[model samples]
Target chain A: MARDTRERLLDAGLALFAGNGLAGTTVSDLEARAGLRAGSGSFYRHFTSKEALFEAVVRQELDRFRTSIGDTTIGESTVADVKIALALEFHEALTTLGQLGQLEAIIHRDAHAMGDLFDEVEGLYNAALDASAARLNQLMESGQLPRRDPQALAVTIRSTLIGYHLNTQSFRRSARRVPPADLIAILIDLISSK
Target chain B: MARDTRERLLDAGLALFAGNGLAGTTVSDLEARAGLRAGSGSFYRHFTSKEALFEAVVRQELDRFRTSIGDTTIGESTVADVKIALALEFHEALTTLGQLGQLEAIIHRDAHAMGDLFDEVEGLYNAALDASAARLNQLMESGQLPRRDPQALAVTIRSTLIGYHLNTQSFRRSARRVPPADLIAILIDLISSK
Candidate 1:
């Protein structure tokens, strides 16, 4: 029961913080969202302060992201299979990016003051890119992929994914009528050895 | 003169809004930054409220962006020249993106509340993408580039550029050692017909 309440509070924190920001959100607001009385001290039971709750929210989101990435294993044998696997990976990453949108807004807003937390987030992002580069390197070595700079290719692939996400989601732009699946297919065609 | 003061106020608002945000910034902050008396009603003479100042700031930034895009012409005759032109375009766009970083954070944070403003920003972004696609289509028609889905290719190229910019600037990640120039070169290689 205690752990459940903690989880609820964290969930509430993520939503509220992402919506209203750290400075805008109040302790009572968090408690109410978490199913506690409006003026009750229940929030204090789980968090010493709003900042603590914000930190917990960020950490929890990161953990969920890390776990999702870890749970997936890419073991495609053919180039076609690799393309399929990559498309799935793109979808999954886009989903995670969408979920983290709120947290990202908060992070970008408070980045100047929250150096340590920002570093943690950036570190995880870089690590993900590195892992992606390693996978691409393996494919190149196996001759399943063309031998370009694997790291550069990884960055290019990741950038294209992120750009598409931002265009459709954050920017809410039309993307010139290029659907995600179409973009992914064209991307694969462009990068794969012909 | 009065016009100079208005310009100063807009400049100050951009810096302050990007740094402290709309809620965190005050009228006095604007006046102080613009070299007026901190608590004076000088700001009132120029703008009705903080919100008005913010609207002006956003419009001014967008206008500047549109103007920059208008002033550039891509007249490259060779594939290699097109690559160089694209690189310069990417650099310019990245600079604009960097300048608008603070406004972007504010937009993402208040997107739910700022419906009309968000629409206006989204329109500009989509228009920019459309222009890029048209340019790419022209290149393809002239046989300077490969005959692929021009719109999709535009998105792919744009996403790569934006991804690299975000990695280096916003996320502050290492990008797995892929520099912007190298990424652009690889991207051209991937998309161009052999």
Candidate 2:
């Protein structure tokens, strides 16, 4: 029962934060958005403050992201399989959390001020790169890809995807738009080449 | 003389915006930072609000970017010259402006809102891509690069640079950084291949 209330509070906080922004949002906003009355009394019963509640939401999101990292079956999957899987969901995860955009915005804002939060953001990116690199290393070792430094190549591919996500924010005007399959195909070609 | 005041205001706005962010900053901050007390009181004499001032600042920075496009001697320069002279400076101008830790936070905030600001952002990116494409077209016409749509290739290169910028914010743990020269070299090689 206690755990469920905490989860509900987080969901409510995410919605409020999304609508109002971190700095723009207030304790009353969270309390009202949660649809729970009893003033600050009930709210404080569950979480210490709005900032604490916001921090919990970030932790929950990071934990969810960490869980997804475990899903990358690098040893079992082919390069093409991994690439396709990544493209399908990567940008969405970065930009949105269901209906709430607060998660991305909150982290992007405070990551500058808070060292620990910044570390978590960095860790998430590195984990993804490491997973991708592991797959590339396997491909090279198996003679599927040309001999390449999997780490460096992984960085390149990872950077390419990061670039792709950023460009997705501005794809409408660019003359060349590479669809997900084509992007993956290009990567496969680049990796498999000598 | 009037034109020079506008220019000085823009120069001051960029430095202040880069340090304090768009929302956190105020006209007083701008005036104090610019060392123009009465002249700064005179700031509103020209622009109505801080928003208007920001729009002016954004325009000035963007114009500086567009000037680099004008500097590209597309028809006269070789592929190597474009990479060394035009492309590298273009990359620098982008990094110098967008890579500021505070400015990106402001951009990230606005971008999350999914508003008309996106169009303005896209226009600047596309302008850069167009400039690069014109140069690439010249190279292809001269039989230096494979004859393909230079616009398409230019978009790809712009996307690659966008990705690097995103990584600077999104990935904090990858101490394995690639210098802009090596990265630009890799991108040039990718697009110029026959």
Fnat, one value per model: 0.67, 0.25
Scored against the true structure, residue B117 in model 1 reaches a CA lDDT of: 73
Off by over 4 Å in 2: A1-9, A12-21, A28-46, A78-105, A170-178, B1-20, B26-48, B74-76, B79-106, B111-118, B133-153, B169-175, B192-194
lDDT of 2 by residue, A2-49 (tens): 456667788887665544455556666666666666355677878987
- Backbone clash pairs for candidate 2 read A163-B163
Q: What is the interface RMSD of each candidate, in Å?
A: 2.3, 3.5
- Give the number of the best model, judged by DockQ: 1
Q: How well is candidate 2 docked (DockQ)?
A: 0.34
Residues B90-178, model 2: lDDT tens digits: 46645654634334444554444435655665666567666667876876786766665565555545555656665655544332566
